[model samples]
Target: MPPVTLKDVAQHAGVSHQTVSNVLNGHPHIRPTTKERVLASIAALDYYPNQAAKALREARTTTVCCVFYGHNPEDISDPYRNLVQSAFIAEAQAHGYSITTAFVNDDADLTQLRQRFLQREFGGAVIVGTVLTPSQVHTFQAWEMPVVLFDHALPSTTNVTADYPEGMAALVQHHVLQGRRRLALIIPEQDLGSTSIRRREGFLQTCARAGVEGAVYDGTWSYDAGYRAMQALWAGESRPDAVLGGNDRIGAGALRAAHDLGLRVPEDVSISGFDDFEFAQFTTPSLTTVHIPHGDMARQAVRGLISLIDGTESESRVFPLSLVVRESA
Candidate 1:
């Protein structure tokens, strides 16, 4: 039997040989429709690139790492994290790359990660879930290994993040337009990532500009946290006219707390949240929140890393955040 070649795949896909080559090399300029046709044709024809010849030409691995901080595989449950990881895996696979997931939480793990990086076991890496310190990021930059920082920004690394500050500002403006003063925020307990910082800054700055009194309650990124924070906020001398949750989980928790306290949401007090998680709409009276494009972010991050690995310059991008209006707010 004859081995399938790039020419065979190109003929099968009805594209030029160079197009097939571009697809195999993960060229960023190819149209998605054309790329899809080429990929499908390759799979249909069971065409596999000549590994040795390819290595002789590029001499680089096709394995990319998705590095997460503060959590291991068995304990991972955040919806956003799960979505982005899945997207990254799919996108990497589409680009003829394999993805390996790793967890780094402390100095020991960081040391191990650096060692693996120095060994050139990964072609590139995507930093997700937690923001690394500036020095740590600089170390990666010094290694000349392509690194994409998701949801965070470092001076020397490629960063991809949603416009969280803009979303927060818009949400606050919406609350003000609704005639809701005395705004309150339910912030997550830990500054888990850069998203938290952006949201906090956006809320504070927007509230100040709007001349709306605001209060903040620290909590975790969970329903229980939202509930507890809401309880604390309401137990004060006066309750907030409008409450903004850090995320849907916290918002859902806050909604339950409000219901338990006999307060009517959007009537007694309006409530809003972020992330637009799956359950955001199902909660009683639903939830109004910001929608972050998880899939898009993941795709861009993977592509950016791939471009970097190919010795092509990849620029940082910030995805615009959009508000999803529902019943809660």
Candidate 2:
């Protein structure tokens, strides 16, 4: 059968095509009874609006784009990205919108980036984990499209982020309570400029208050970074009794390094991680890490974007993080 059209609904409801259009667009001029009759006809015919047709009529696209900029595209493969993106997808679908993804390597051309978004006819954008250059952000602002930013600081654009400081403090407090006198923190060097920086601040402040000596190691937020940082710690004359990683991947790497060096977890040394990824449980000893609620953060980000699209103002939101205790710590 041919696709159902507004004309069919108009004919069935005994109204003009314009009346059906008004009802669909929420023109607020149609009679209540007339609106009901038109809606019933639409349902009876199982009419679904063609998005292309609606876009043509409204002169606006119904799609949003998300651009992620970073040193390595693989960084998003972390569990944090997985959870946030998953939530964003589900929430966008619920709001009758779709998302497009783009990547920008460091120092890419702004004009080229704009062309990509234009080619896709993106109605708006959500940038995740990318530190937008001031000019890039200005470009998006100039386009006058709704934009939401995540993980990076942007003036003028709305943002959603995790409470890294509080989460880090909790992790350190846990270690202190466990009687860990010498503590160390391992973080990706890249993260020193972002959320990881906040985590470090929390850790150090807590350590000072608790009077525990603390050290920091700069590395990648990966298993390799964690392993290397741990190795470096072992080689040092004064080793920390406890180590905290920036995220779960780093934590896992630290665990491997400890195992290889004949240090039993929690018995010989204590280790912990953040972002309770899927692999956190299966490690030799289950990981005690901070659970960054990615799903919840994603949901909030999408909701904020939807509100923006609908011309509703949403307050800046922060999601809470929790500590998941297991054998490693």
Candidate 3:
């Protein structure tokens, strides 16, 4: 079938296309009964406004840049990152906008990207993942361009982030409530971003409140990191009764390491993770993890940036994470 248009709706309603437009745009001159008829016709025809033509007439550029500050192009393959990227793309396209992706590997690359952004190369930008340095972040703060920051917390900026503290606290509470007093947390060796920092803060505070013993181990954002963190923790004279990973990737690694060391999950030790990635549910005993709303966050980030570009106010939004209980914990 052909695409439904304003004219089609107008014809079905037995009115001019301009009348349909007037009704759709909330023009007050139209009668209530007439508006009802036009709306009914619209519903029947399933007509949608042509955003592409509207943007063209308004002289609005439909291109936005999604910059990954501290990640390599290869990093986009990670499940969390992949989900966010795909979601943003779909949402932007739905709004008749396009996304251009750029990767900033280091400080030098970040500086150069800033220069391009200053030239008005994009209608707006969504900063995803992480940043390389404090100065690089400062550059984003001082820029005149409309931008949305994701996963990072900064005053006076539009941000979209998950409730990391609450998620981490729930994980800690789950383990401690099950009578696991001694715990270990495995996190990325790279500079802990705002999300990681918040998670750590929650873990520490919750452990203190519950009178549980917990320790942090540094590792990468990968399976090896979880594996190595567990190995290092076991190298000591004692072992934790439970282990929590920063993300599912690390959690899966911890599970592997534990099995390799002849330990049983939730029997010898309980293990849980953040970001309930697909693999989390498929582990030997199904890992318990935190479920972050990645798709929703991506949509919000895109909408916020578009709002900024349209000279509208968009406030920062923090979404809550849910705990997924499973046999691993």
* Best-matching candidate per TM-score: 1
Question: Candidate 3 on 1-329: residue-level lDDT in tens?
Answer: 67778888888999999998887666879887787788778656645466453343345577888888777687655887788889989999999998888887754355445544543446778998554345655566666668889887776778898899999998898898899999989986456688878888888899999998988888878988898888777778878999999899999999999988888899999988899888889998899999998899999999999999898999999999999999999
- What pairs collide in candidate 2? none
Q: How accurate locally is residue 59 in candidate 3, as Cα lDDT from 0 to 100?
A: 54
Q: Candidate 3 regions off by >4 Å?
A: 1-59, 111-120, 132-138, 141-143
List the candidate numbers ranked by lDDT, top first: 1, 3, 2
Where's the lowest-lDDT run of ten residues in candidate 2?
A: 106-115
Clashing pairs in 1: 189-219
Candidate 2 lDDT (Cα, 0 to 1): 0.78
Provide the lowest-lDDT 10-residue window in model 3: 51-60
Output the number of the lDDT-best candidate: 1
For model 2, give the RMSD to the true fold. Answer: 14.3
**lDDT score of residue 156 within candidate 3:** 71
Clashes of 2: 0
User: How much RMSD separates candidate 1 from the native structure?
Assistant: 14.1
Supply candidate 1's per-residue lDDT for 309.
Answer: 92
What TM-score goes with each of the models?
0.79, 0.77, 0.78
- Which pairs clash (backbone N, Cα, C closer than 3 Å) in model 3? 189-219
